[model samples]
Target chain A: MASKLDLDPRVVRSARRLAAKAGQPVVDLARSHTTVSVERAVLRLAGVQGADQDGIPWVNRLVDAVRADVGLGHGVAVPVFHAMRSTGVDDITVLAQKAAAGAVRFDVPSSRSEVAAVKRAAKRATGGGLKIVDRRRAERERLVKRLGDPKQRPWIYLIVATGDIYEDIPQAQAAARAGADVIAVIRSTGQSLLDYVPEGATREGFAGTYATQENFRLMRAALDETSRELGRYVRLTNYASGLCMPEIAALAGMERLDMMLNDSMYGILFRDINPIRTFVDQRFSRQVHARAGIIINTGEDNYLTTADAVEAAHTVTVSQLLNEFFAHEAGLEDWQLGLGHAFEINPELPESFRLELAHALLARELFPDAPLKWMPPTKHMTGDVFRGNLLDGFFNLVGALTGQGILLVGMMTEAVVTPWLSDRDIALQNVRYVLTGAGNLHEDFAPAPGGFIQQRADEVLGEAVDLLAKIVDDSLLTAIAEGTFGIMKRPADRGKGLDGVARHDDDYYNPVTEALEA
Target chain B: MSIVRPYGDTTGDGMVQLSFTLPIPHDKRAEGAAVQLANKMGMDPALLVHARPMGDGFTFFVVYGKVSHLVDTEKVQVVERDYPLLSAKEVNATIKRRLRRRLNVVGACIGTDAHTVGIDAILNLKGIAGEKGLEYYSELSVTNMGAQVSVPDLVETARERKADAVLVSQVVTQRDAHLQNTRAMSAAFREALPAGKRPLLIVGGPRFDELMAGELGVDRIFSRGTTPREVASYLVHALVGSSS
Candidate 1:
């Protein structure tokens, strides 16, 4: 797509170059280290599942036992595989039981041939799991082709969190009927802070449903049925982030989820997951997402919630560019980059709608092929339903005018209650009214020559370039520690999950990464 | 007498001042464009009163104009607060006399909501805006579980504590996560505890609709500017004595 705005191509190039420079060190750091979660992801891919009688997952128990014994530096693959090779046991559950009973011990591989044999054996064990993921990807392609795409630009995304997976099915189906193209099962609160993914289909959760393998399967199956009925392929979304980022991504891939909220900085900034741990985990997760053909939505929108949207608009742009770089490095195409931003500028701010237009249009133009996840207003909803409804109307109008790809319908009763089904109906109606009214407004509208919209976009881009340049000089870690991104300073060495991070040893091996790369 | 109109400088004038950013530099041309855009937006005789350069290419402007619109107040309906405000003493007295025991309240910022300011203001001993939080009440046992609490864990804590009320404070309503979280909480509590044993499911946030509480499966919804006293009194009224 040609540039719609009169932005200088050179400035855009400069911003990209600076973002790449800023992200290079973090990428290098991610490559050199592996967190406990990453190692657990490897085990999960190798088909180590089921919980002990205490409901603790076998993967967590295995990883905990491994980390406790030899520590994480040697990578869990080599030790677990070596144990399997030594004991002639092919079953991960049996190995887990023996390891739990203190009957088996892990020793680092001594020779190159032994390392090769262990990796080959590990790959042999996890080959079925990789095939399952591939099968899911193939199924998604088949379904998308069978059910035609939505006849619109930004797909309406809705969320359903009934805690029980069974209850969520009907709500999700109803949302699909209400014209939502994407259904994101919001995960239970504090799930991100947990080191282990819960096992099985959980019926009870707080704030959202548990992101279990069984739950993913159930939701995917239900969504497939809905997709068939709707004749427009309905997509599934989930968070493949937090402590077990890569593990969730692997699960999401196996379930054929269409999109994943896999941000690099989200855990570090919001959930207090260690920065090094998140950075290391995010790379492996993005790799899985890229391989699964899942569009990865970055959490730059969350930054605006903590930081001022108007003042920190450039930060969102800067993070989007960085997210693009990381996604590309993980082999994701532009279309797979669902970069996130929000309509969160204080509605009371003068020209807030105009500013929102500038920001949204800028994002659309910057990553023309990327599916931008445009979030709804949440920052300044004062509970007056009348005014809130009016604000949401303007928000929908901006989304239409800017051509956002994944439009989260804004609710008039936000910041209040779990919106009733009626609230979602009204919200959907609001979106439908504006969207149907001015769906093609983008084609007819262009910023006035040298007007506020164009000027704001350029200024934000310029500032992002400057910020990226400084980040490159001072390092991304330093900037994060200084609260540059979300007004939340997270140090590299501190915070949760840092204890799980370890520098990779030469003998380390991961069959999943090897298979995906191959 | 019943009809009302927006009065700025005079009755029914509908005079308004709006500010916005233009891509052009802060110059005469940009000011003219600002006025033109304002006029296009239904502002009659729009005048650019202020213009300033934001950056190299952007300019911000404040425009003054009159809108040819009248808001008929009588035709508008709002979700007004139907309950009366009760004092803290009356609330505690009502709970003590009716329930014959202290009220147990457990509150948390469930899900990914790390912002605990809202929760803290209601549950903490420090309170907000000089109003004493639930902890300051002698008849109320408040358990503040902090941020990022899961719904299952919250329900477990509520069950263990034998809570009379479960208060959830969510500051991050981004993508309706707060609302979704509340529904999940309500559902979990409903499924986990029997109706008679179930704690009153209460949620408070800046973006919540107080009138939609029953529909969201919650016992009550508290919006922004709700004081700890308001919550305490409401708890007393709903759980202990409806006539209070």
Candidate 2:
């Protein structure tokens, strides 16, 4: 795809270089450190399962025991595998139970041979789980090939977050029947802040469903059934973020989820998860996502909710470029980069729709191969269903005209209540109306030369390049600490989950990460 | 006088400008197609004023045209703000005089709705749109739980805090998670708290229906562009004053 705005190739190259330079420090930091979540993810890959009587996951319990005994510098894998080898227990759950019952202890490996023996045991243990992940990935590709793609570019990505996994299935199927191409099972509120993923089937959730491994398997099966029924693949999405980012990503992969909301800075900026912890966790998670072929949707749109969308447009673009660099570094292809933006400029601002077009089209042109997740209006819904519907109509038009990849349908009765099924039906109708009405609108539209849209895109690109240069100079971590991206200042060392981060010892071993990287 | 029309350049003229994109390269043929498409959409004598190529096989166009449509203003139904916007001082004074204690309010982004700007705008001390948030009010005790708060936890917090109002902000309305979460929160409160002791349930987001609070089982529903002062005033009215 050629540049729509004829964006200066020099600026693009400069921005790319600066973003690469800016992200290197964080990437190096991620390489040097491993969070408790990363260790838990390793244990999960080694086939650790279930919680104790306190509902704590065995992976968490094992990591806790290891952290308490060996102080976590040598990584949980080394200590846990040494414990497994010494105890002569092939099952990690049994080892966890014994450790939890205080029947076993973990300390630093006594010798080089002990370390080598533990690494070999860890490799053998995690090999089965990695095979399962590989099988799931192959199964996902097989199913998609068999079921076929949706008939359009911007697949209608609806959501079903009924707290209860069972309750979500029917709603999801109804949405697919109603023209939705993708169904995202929204995780329950605050799940991201939790250090462990919930086990088994969960019945009660507050705002959204839990992103447990069992829950993921169930929802994936349901969506697969729906896909077969609809004759087009219906992708399932869930978040692999928060304190247990890599663990959830591993689970999403094992359950064959098609997409994951795996952003680097979202937890740090929004949930206040520590920057070091988030960066480390995001790298491992993106590795799993990349291996599983999961398209990741970054959270650049959330910036608009906190900062002024118009004044901060450049920040979103800058973040996208950074996210791109990070994703590429994690071995993800451009096709799997569902980079996010939103149609969230204040509607009262004159020519807001045109401005939205300029922004959305700029993203579309900038990352042409990437499937951009175009978010609907949340910052300006206004609670008036009539106006909200109209605003969504305009949003859909912009998506259709600009060629967004994933379009989350907007509900009209937003801010009023939990949408009754009727509200979803109406919202879907609004999308269908605009998308079908202006289905080919993109073929008939282009910005005027040197007009507001063209000029805005150029100006935003210029601002983004300057910001990238500053970020490269000061480093991304310092910029984040000083509130650069989302206006939320999150210091590198201060915030939630900082205690979970550990500087990896040279001998620390993670078979899963090594396998993914290999 | 009762009727209205799009007042673009002049009243009753119905003149408008529409912009669009075509896949064909920008040329005489693309400009002609833009005009033809505009005419089909009810614009008469549509004139293509601008045309530009956007990459390969794509063209954008801006067209000016006239329409023959008018809207009757009298029949336009809207959900208007019935409550008056009060000053922060008035809100604090009313709460102090009537309740004789601080108004405890707990706000959160319950469910998976991680967007917190709306909840923060009303509950955080910084506020939005040049107005102070509920935290700035002297008589309002605001405890913002931040994003992704569970309903059961929100209920427990409301109970423990002895809250006068429980504000839940939902930013992700995908598949009606916001609405469902609100309903679930309201139901949890109904089950947990006695009718007389239950906190005033308030849910605000950009996409809420102002009139559906009763249906959604909440005390009040605030919509877009809501200021903290207005929320504070409403709390004073519903919880402290004669309106209760």
Candidate 3:
């Protein structure tokens, strides 16, 4: 993988340095603070299951009870384990139910030995859950080895979201047989806004299926069966973002999901999750993802949906560098980084195709080892199927020529309707044709020295360097408040879930975070 | 009477191809079931062309069929473009002369619909498909509330801005959310304001049926391919020109 764009090595080093410097303060802030979702995720790992009568998760109930009784500064683990020891309730779920019912009370241990015992018990209980996560990861590796990987360079990723778990299973299997290497069950609309994860299998959803644990298990089991039949292990993906970011990440890990839509700034900018809360939750979620051997997909593709891709090309690069820094800081390997970019330039513009190649090739060349997730054209899909299909063909050509790792199939009926099965078949045909025709085109394709593609890539890289310098000076939080990335201004102190953030006290303890850090 | 039949390859052939998914696996009986369903819908000579197992117990099918149903041109009902397609100058002049003030507009995507592309295309200065949006008009003052607005907030904004027209865009129509949100919005406006004082309600989306405006309790329904010029002209026709 030679540098097709001939990017300057000196400028790349400077940009990475600036990004690491700019992201350091946010990482420090995450280390010193914790969110309700992070603690709830810890409780989930400690084997707290089920929800109350109103469908609120038991983890949420237990966390709320602990936070109310003894403020969350010391974390929920100490108070809950103390209650468990005093009541002799070995089952964490039973203790959570009793706590939610106001029948059990939690107290911070007074003696030093008592505190040590409670900490050890908390660690041991969550350790059991981690063992299960470890086993699931091992199971996935064994299956992949036996079933074999997809016989393609760029894995064909497709989405099937029928709202019902039962319905999505068949559609997902159909997609796997149709040559999709990865099947992503899109989360239900606004599931990101819900503070608690939904429990059990769900039937009614607005646009997509709910990313419940039961739904995850169901889809994983079905895909495993399909993998055995097809002899190519089909991967499953789900969103581990929004208000319940860490909880979803933990669930994805326990269910052996291969990929998670885990991004740092996506929830803060798009879903309006508080910046502080998002940062804290994303850190823990990424750690979980790293441990589960899941490739985390960052949401830099979303920036182009709102801003003009040509004008905001530098922002995508800057965000990618920042996301890379964050992912590495969380202990993720280079192979586990599915960094995202999109083909969202207005096709009517002169030389739009050339501009797309420059941007895609820039991303491809910068993070050569990372599995760059190239997204399809979305903002310009105008319901004209014939023209839309042609636009997608061009998109696939660029993906093939640039050697992207994961390609989300572009639908001709994107803006018109949820794609019918025939629409998916036609879309897959477009992908297959281009990929087969130009699969090795990248080996031969190289932009001319000082040509338009090389110059454009250089220009975007230079702008990213300047932007990173400014972000370092003004601070990333302030830059975000001024709408630096996706043109969405999200203040640190504003947005939803800000109230859920708590600064750690001197005695703060979370066994899962401790384990993950270890 | 001018009558017409569908034409696939020949004129008046009444031939069509339909695709659908069934709950049963791909088998002979499933293919027969597809034909039976098509025949029930008046495709007398239905032919199953393709059938494949979608998953464990579901099947997808493509059927070629012919029906005797004919469409009478005179009996067709549609919501034609009833207003003139005015230029930007004409629209501004008419609004200024008729109302003696700038026409105020408020737009949003209500009820968990986060897509602001449609609303932005109509209200922002950058219009879709080469036409400038309503904000380009000198005699129009626009208030774009962006995405994920609630119905109550929309009504409050409309009343506060003294809006002459309130436009809403719904892009996520899964489970008919667009229809449900439109009905709820229109009902809220009706309850909050008197008939004469309430602002004209216009709902737009890609999936909306234009003929269902009355049924959905909105004053106008703008379907796909609706440009800002059409919306501005309709505002003049309904509010300004009607009074004049």
Q: Which 10-residue window in model 3 chain A sums to the lowest lDDT?
A: A482-491
- Candidates, ranked, TM-score: 3, 2, 1
lDDT of 1 by residue, A299-330 (tens): 99888776678989999999999999989988
TM-score, model 1 to reference: 0.73
Candidate ranking (lDDT, best to worst): 3, 2, 1
- After superposing the true interface residues, what Cα RMSD does each candidate give? 15.0, 11.9, 2.7
Which candidate would rank higher by lDDT, 1 or 3?
3
> Number of clashes in model 1?
15
Candidate 3, DockQ to 2 decimals? 0.34
True-structure lDDT of candidate 2: 0.86
Listed per prediction, chain B TM-scores read 0.85, 0.80, 0.92
Better of 1 and 2 by DockQ: 2
Local accuracy by lDDT, each model: 0.85, 0.86, 0.92
Q: What is the interface RMSD of candidate 3, in Å?
A: 2.7
Q: Write the per-residue lDDT of candidate 1 for residues B62-136, one digit (tens) a residue.
A: 788888766677777665655656777777777778888899999998887867768777876657656878888
When 2 and 3 are scored with lDDT, the better candidate is 3
Off by over 4 Å in 1: B1-146, B149-223, B226-244
